[model samples]
Target chain A: MPWAIAAPNTPPPPTWGIFTPGTVGQFFFVIVYSAVIYWLISRAKAGMPVPEIRKIAGLDAFDEAVGRATEMGRPVHFTPGFYAFSSHTLAAFSILAHVASLCARYDTRLIVTTLNATNHPVLEEIVRQAYLEVGKPDSFNREDVRYLSGYQFAYTAGVVGIFHREKVAANFMMGWFLGEALVIAEAGALAGAIQIAGCPAVVQLPYLVASCDYALIGDELYAASAYLSKDPVMVGTLIAVDWFKMFITGLIVIGVVFANLGSKAFMNFITK
Target chain B: MRRQLPVWLGFIAGMLVIIARYFAFPGFTQVQKTLDNWAMYSGAAAFLMGMINLTIVHKTNIQRRRENWGASLVLLIAMFGYFIYGLFTGPDDKLFVSIFNATISPLGSAMFSLLAFYMLSAAYRAFRMKTLEATILLAAGLIGILGNAPIGAAISPWIPSARNWMTEILNTAAMRAVTIGTALGAYAAMVRILLGIERSYLGGRGD
Candidate 1:
């Protein structure tokens, strides 16, 4: 009686010791999505043309930011926001790799301040490798990749201090940010640093966009690694994602239309 | 091996979670639960790493007598002193709680208060009538500000209605679109990681 009341008007899912019945749709979607990605990856590997991702202004500014620091003989500052290991941080790492390489090539100083300690060692290694890749391994300073306070506002204070003390030429703030977003970016702006910022946090997006010279909005932060790397595999994966978005859009449209026609069939299929 | 090991582990763990989520397989729930616990444990372990790093970095600053070395010394004293005190008295102890409330809480709040000033500065720069979009943004910002204040309703009934429409309809729609796009982007990123294509997290170049 309790089970019936809890799941009123719903029959039990038929299971054959395999896929969960209700999850069949999601499972199939994942398989199709993965297959599409893999196929695109293979095509990219074979040098086949894929849809070129549009140029992102924030990513395009990376080299320019590093070069400005070099020309001005000032250091460039970067932080991957206040989060620990997450997709956003991973994307930030890709940007850092490119920035480090550019700094190495130009012999400009790059100072990385990390809020998450676990990300510190990884960031250090990326900077070191980037310098090595650019044939300037000796120029790499481990001390420059600093692990600042883990507390959100404390990290912001540290970044603000760096901006004021070092008088950085360029500042890059990428990854997940929260209330502290404007504090750091505005500090950079006040210090006369050219700033580029990206964050997936919607609430903080306005602050970053308003303060930073260039801001990567929404998924742009995720797209950054692929955009900057210009690697075939990465680019291919991005294209596949776009295709899947179109598919989802189509489903949404269909569901809307069916609902308008007084049919719950499509809606039930999706909700199932 | 240093690089490859992490990639394999990530792939394995990712697949396990995916299967456990979508498949009616037995024992996978237990596996997922175990992995989640491991993740929690590692995160706690990483905090200790953060402490060690903080000490080393600040110690160097003090040794070199770097600019603001005094601040570093104070930070170290505060950090370790508070830590040791907490260890002995426990976080629930009145003294420990009082110290946190006295120092860290107030300091954090003070830093957060700076955001209002920063926001004003940012808004000043952003609201400049340099472009059409900026002009629209300025209009929207004014509306949003007015909508939140008591005087806005006094100005005109329509002003509040317009602000409500903008916030409820326009802002919500835009935020939802961004949220959708971000979800897809994150999914793509995860796919890359699972496939061993996105290796930047391994402290190397992405494939």
Candidate 2:
């Protein structure tokens, strides 16, 4: 009975208690990456030329979609999907501002739907400001910036209803999404609305690609703010990100090599 | 001041969070908890604002007798009715739970069930033999379907192995690449925001 008892195993104590346990590698990456990004940003701030961003067809279609909506005399519909103050939603806000300005300049109605109540106020402010910036403050309608529902499917139903009722000429789906991605995109397709969808959600990308006229795949959604604004600092940050991606690719290759050689040393080092 | 205040506040909070993540500083956990609680409280307050917005929008529709005014009225009634009832009964009340389970749950499921038809239509549109990429996608999709079905194994052993390789190797590798790219992009965006460079979220271009 005494032999049946097991010894307790615990992690080793932290050295110097400076960094969080098991996060040394992460901290190293953060410092190096931030340093690289800041260096590029400073260069951009000093008016040095940075590498140009490649063309994203989905983003390029923004003006065309807005123009189509204007010519058709129909409202442009946009949803930032269901998220609360995420990076995806922030990117969505930039896109929303661009779309809102286009709508204001064209004197076309823009309808925005939000699943999260928290985003409603910010979205309304963004839309209102966009209109104001474009010298069409009077065209900003508070009612059009709607908070649909917190429930996923309910939001989908509401968006689908709007698509049919308002006869939306163009639909833009941006931000984080779930199962509702395809339903909304397909509903827009059924409504004959030219659709543009973007999200970092991998599982939902195929649906957007198949159903929407154009889709921003993966990091393209993150590239949106820089792509739309064409700000040098943002562009510089994107280039830094590309370099970091290369760094990660290198790590992946090394990890693969170690794995094939039957060694867990690299894996443990990474997890450290 | 109106604009600069938010950016400064954002920078402070973002730095604090980053520090807390990387270092084991005293009181950091408590500060993080407080920040989370503040976020929840802010969300609650925003819910009230959203309620007001809904009422205003729908009330206007009903007052002006717009198209689908009846639907608007119905929506307002249902929303307020359930809200008031929940307020009185509490969320854990048996009747409240039962009502939610009976109506909202089933409705959500029904809405989700519509995805099957949507997927079919989307697949049909995407699988058209128009381009090389489309042809590859169509062929892969057919193989994937066959591999999943029992009849596929009866036809050929290679079909299942091919499907497994496609999903396990090709699909997973692509997914990992996308996931990594997304993480890097998000981190970069966060850096820009924290450094007070990207002010697009504050209704301004990066100035």
Candidate 3:
């Protein structure tokens, strides 16, 4: 019989299988994020009436707090809350940027303490940039940006020490805080620092509200950047997010109505 | 030239990462992976910078014979001790494990427990019936706190049920409203960052 040509039964490389799905998903997420971001930017540029953000008592007090520090001639302590790399921290950074600018403009010393070593460089950059923006780059002191420690309590202790020693006139805590929130807040209070604290951590909010002169509750922290910048993209995204919330609310209402009527189908649909 | 290069690079890299995330293109995906790796490494590298900054400040204080040199010495010792322990000892080592469990763990727990006392004091101060809002907040907080504790259940069976109802109906609703509002705000800010309208992050030198 003539020689038969056999087809190769070799399997595709395992590497290909591993690479494909992850890459695709990542790509998809990035594109969606970009599109939303772009839409927001365009809206901002077009001068869309950025929905008026309700004045947060905490944010309003920021100026007063800074002014108090200036009058007292004491350094203002600012700790951008715990998570160094999170979006919340970035938002906090934006607020810090603005606050730093205010500090520079007022010719007051601002002391920023970072919990994580990794955050130090970024924070230093943020402070420097803020000063530069305010036309006081020369006044941006490297000593003012301190790295306390990575450990939570260690960081808190360091901050409290700074509070007492420096007699911080104002304290701004913005970011992802846990139990240390109250410790720092209480310390600030004891130091007679006009404290403004903003964090998304629900548990910490009450503590902040109680001890701090001003408390940015829940989502107000997220709104800080947009509120400070008045950037259009931020405004547009805010609108879109509201729409999303409405949809969620509608769903909740429907589910509640069906549950009350004892509709198994509706209940099951919601439970799923 | 220095400033412009960084700006362009940041813009291009940022867009690439975003696009790569959105699309399934291999090239884009690779770029993103590379960027992510770079971010991780860069983040790690920042530790050295932080150490340098810390040392500089503390050393300067010591050299200047600044006030509270004793505290600085204690801090330096503690830092070095922790670093040495972490570096040298494996988790399997009894001494290391005990130190972690007994000393570190308890200290952390104690710090967290400290909040309870502060919170009570702070709440007492904040919940003064000064305004209508304050009065409502006080009432809600009282209910919420009682509901969460065991004493509320022991005091009255109905109290727990009432607390549960309040949490489910009122607390949930209020929290949800806040969440929605925050989500919107966050989305807006993210959009600004992506569009490069928020270049204040790049520093004042714009590098």
Candidate 4:
């Protein structure tokens, strides 16, 4: 035992070799980050100051899109993008509920297309409930909530076909769209439908902007439901998010200045 | 009750996985992994459910002599061919891969490319220089496009530099704001789901 201590040269086990300061530090950082997110949410319920959101042009066009359909005497085509289960999809679903309710109130025909078969029953129910809530239960059409093919391109083709055949006056595309964003938007354009598109796919934003009358770029897609429905929790969360953003921006500014001055100690302390 | 049981189980399983990932507990992590494996297997099995549903629909279409009868026949043949190919030659076989790559890939690309033409037409028809906002959008788009292109750089280095600055500084700030807002919204939605307040997923009647 004395000889082993004196030597003090043997490497640790292969798995434990990298169990150094950096590894320990990173492990702790993740824990702290997660804890902070949890704490933020807990404290957020108490209420936060509302952040002033600059007007989103895409949202202002919602009424215009609906009005166009009404004027044209054509049904509104609303596809909640391709995602059926994601957070983006849920946001889209919430928006769909609002839009359906509005359509019911306006006595306008609403056509919903789902790329996924599983989404059919849920979407049908959503439409039914929305219509009932608006005192227009009879306006809800089972045939309108059609489930097209699950094949991505096939679904796009089917939607485009419908747009051409029905001459949909207004087209609302919101959720997790991919390459099909431009294709769908273009079809709506060809059909003379006033198109409003919202997708988190940044790469596809250019296509949407070029094709659709109104495009909700990136994160504004998430704000669609909140803006439409004015839910307290939704609005409160939006405010909390702004506070978080402000905190991040302040940290970035301070960090930049400190790093420029070569204050390693201050930088490390602040980062920690 | 069947749906409710699954939903409850899903909620419990989801919470356990999150906790396991956060806490670095070996036992919890193992449980989470096991549950994930089960889910993967179940997902594979669920493919049969979809296949069955599709078959039923196509069969009905054929029996009723629906409007798209020829399309139904083509679909049935393709499906059966796919199944036979998988059964006899395996999924990694050259024939299967070649057919998929040849048929599906090009069709997908062609479909996606349709957007470009549509965009040009849409822009021509809808993008009127009517309001101040519209003017601003048109200007920003033009600048953004020019900045990204090689032609802009060839004409003047300042165009590319300006584009870089706009993308890095202005766009980054805007994007960050949106990300924060989205994250908060998602967090709120997750809370609603956890508390069983958002029962839209459960369809109607709330169970």
Candidate 5:
């Protein structure tokens, strides 16, 4: 029925109140999963022990990169990648805040570039506050936080120009990078900058890995922020997500086993 | 209140959209259209944010007489010139289209074309058999690269089959893992934001 086309004059189907009838199972699943995560997070906030998150090498290199920038008397370059209000952008901002704070502490010049038009204003404020928090409010320069270009390739070109011109000692690229990841990263490599890149963009992961000195793969991009900030709430969310992933993996294996045995009940319930 | 208001609004609007998907009521379509329009208008208005920041940044550079500040001046002039031209002649005018096609389009393509050379350099470094993992990765990559190229078929028939197997089986499995991990991470991040647990966007002082 979902696939079938209705007659031109036919009346539309009736609604199933506020929740879709077929998706009730999905809604329930989400709610249950959320509840579990919420409970774990609450427990974590209460100072209960949660499983330790893996030590992400790329995240660990952030402080080293910042230190290197400080020692070399060169600026640190950061980009949140091309994003317009996405989860990846949010993750990127957390790292930006962390990096900016470190730069402020080290009295190192920090240059943050954004390709997304909307992110530019918010990013400026974020870097400003980060400097303020580190007691170096006067160090935040407006010129350094540039909104290069809204277009992806133009942004890449602009970033490449910066790497060549400014001669940044350490470059941190964390966000929703895509095809231009390599172009910018390769420029960083050529400039002899300690390049650390992270993105959940799997298609571009290989490129980042190839070009960057350190690459955060898969969920590491999301987890890196928590690792850097060491915020209880962020850490709690990270831990909860790992457990949920394991739960989903279990479900997937069970589903596959049942499916192989010609049992379509689980699939039917989800689809229905 | 700075963070709370926006967070509350986002949560309410997101819930409305989610709820709207279930019910095909008489007025649901109109509500969806209204919400979509508001989002579109907001996104369009964001271009102004970019313009203001661009002006501020370049203006500072020019004031300080920073290195290559001339480029910033040129950018400002070019941007305003284009804006004035579009304002008077309309954006759809032949001149406007001609300028965009001649300059902007080609410049964009030029930047994109540079990616090929960058890719070669990156691949050259990555494909080096420096470590066990690197060697295995280089092997897999070689299979993928050669299988797609015409020369692979000329070299050996099995090369193409091996490439297809590596991509269709091994690559697909790895891709799925990454996809699922990213989906979960993104979903969890959104949930945290909606619940007001994540407030980095607000530049809040954490407890």
Candidate 6:
């Protein structure tokens, strides 16, 4: 049998030359999906009254965490979950910029440790700019921005060490965390620091939920920076995402009903 | 211009990567491959830059006699020593691999095993039956664990079936929802950057 249905004993036909045929549906949606976001962004930019977006508690806690750090006279620690450039890391950086600004405004020390060699300079620059934007450039300490290690577990261990040694007041974890998430998050918890963690890695949610005071579950992590910044364009993108999700969820529920009622038509239609 | 250049470059490069995926244009793949090759080279250069940065930071610490500066010294030695050794023997050489295995393998395992204890702690906290939802979650988790364990078969024949059903049905459904939501969220974020709406990642740069 062939991978999705074909004549028995027949060699699989040549792959589709145009439009990665198997993925055309998803590809088409990707375009439509971005278009929807663009449209919403435009609307908001035009001063349209966008509906109030749902509150993400993890996001709401960001300033609170930063404030706590300031009050406690301890530094704030930030690590974007994974290393290198990806959507997860990119999203995480958005939050990092925000957190850095908070640290700068409060004149509290900020420690950023990274495992990705490429992101190191960019992260540092972001923090520096954040301080400069807040008119506190001289207060920014280059030494506090660390490139811990290129190794995953080594970075985790180093972060744990920072949590203990620095006695961090607030811990922010966001990005593409893998197996090292729990090790680091637990360290933050043990240090009695207020923690807000978010990652695209679904399996790591349990650890974050248990250890962190607030956990950005799933896409909430992605929506975080937009949610925190409250810029019209960013908020518009979020509004678009939420609307699209509702639409997709409706389709899913209907498709499920049809599937249960003995119909493959919806599946075939979507897959096509 | 400084800010605008990165936005334009990112948009063009990202679109090219996306286009190269679905369209098998004659030279598109080659162009994409070339771009990727350039990225890898840049990443290697970045690695060197990172090493230099690490050295500078630690050297300052040592000079200042800062707290735990000895650890910084050891870190520098280990880092540069490994770098020199790897340069001489190549990354895949037996000695290099042996050293890597001795260091990373066990350390990674230790970190991974720490997950078990952390998981237990997390589970104990999360699985508390504080509310109806928590109780249901606890039930589902217990069933999932027992179903995977050998003892489930010994405990009750129906338990395994229940666990399998929950995983194959409920767990998969929830996971699908999460995966799709994340994909869309990521997609929106990508579009935002492409459109230059989310330019903070560009570090307070241009329109």
The TM-scores of chain A alone, one per candidate, are 0.90, 0.93, 0.81, 0.77, 0.91, 0.91
Please list the Cα RMSD from the true structure of every candidate, rounded to 1 decimal place. Answer: 3.2, 2.3, 7.1, 6.6, 3.2, 3.8
- For model 2, residues A1-272, the per-residue Cα lDDT tens digits are 87786878865565347777888888888899999999999999999999987889999999999999999999999999788898899888888888888888899899999989999999999889888888878888999999988889988999999999999999999999999999999989998999999989999988899999999988888888887888898899999888988999999899999999999999988778
- Winner of 4 and 5 under DockQ: 5
RMSD of 6: 3.8
Highest DockQ among the candidates is held by which one? Answer: 2
Alpha-carbon runs more than 4 Å astray in model 4: A1-73, A103-109, A116-121, A128-143, A263-272, B1-11, B34-73, B80-89, B122-128, B132-154, B204-207
Candidate 5 residue lDDT tens string, A1-272: 79898768854444355554576666777777778768877887898887778788898888899999999999999999887777788888877888888898999999999888778877888889888888878998987888887788878888999999999999999888877888899999999999999888888998999889999887887776666667676677787678877877898898899899999998887655
**TM-score for each prediction?**
0.93, 0.96, 0.80, 0.75, 0.92, 0.92
Which runs of model 3 end up more than 4 angstroms from their true locations? A1-40, A47-51, A231-244, A254-272, B1-39, B81-103, B145-156, B204-207
Name the regions of candidate 1 deviating beyond 4 angstroms. Answer: A1-22
lDDT of 1: 0.86
lDDT of 5 by residue, B64-173 (tens): 99999999999999888998899999978999989988987888889888889999999899889999988998888888888999999999999999999988898888
Clashing pairs in 4: none
**Best candidate (score: lDDT):** 2
The candidate that wins on TM-score is 2
What tens digits encode model 1's per-residue C-alpha lDDT throughout B16-109?
Answer: 9999988776689789999989977887887787788789888999999999999989989999998999899887999889887887778899
DockQ of each: 0.65, 0.77, 0.41, 0.33, 0.58, 0.61
lDDT by residue for model 3 (B1-207), tens:
744565567668867865664444678988898988987897788777777787788878888889987777776776667667867875577877776688767777877777778888788878999999889879878877888899988888877888899988986777767766666556555655655556555554232
lDDT of 2 by residue, B81-112 (tens): 98999999899999889988998899999999
Which of candidates 3 and 4 reaches a greater TM-score?
A: 3
Judged by DockQ cut-offs, the docking class of candidate 1 is: medium
Residue A93 alpha-carbon offset, candidate 3, angstroms:
1.1
List residue ranges in candidate 6 displaced over 4 A: A1-17, A257-265, B150-158, B204-207
Q: Distance (Å) between predicted and true CA of A63, model 2?
A: 0.6
Q: Native contacts recovered, in order, as a fraction for each? A: 0.66, 0.71, 0.55, 0.29, 0.57, 0.63
- Worst lDDT run of 10 residues, candidate 4 chain B, spans B198-207
lDDT (0-100) at residue B6 of candidate 4?
49
Candidate 5 stretches with Cα past 4 Å from truth are A1-18, B21-33, B204-207
Model 5: residue B114 alpha-carbon error in angstroms:
1.2
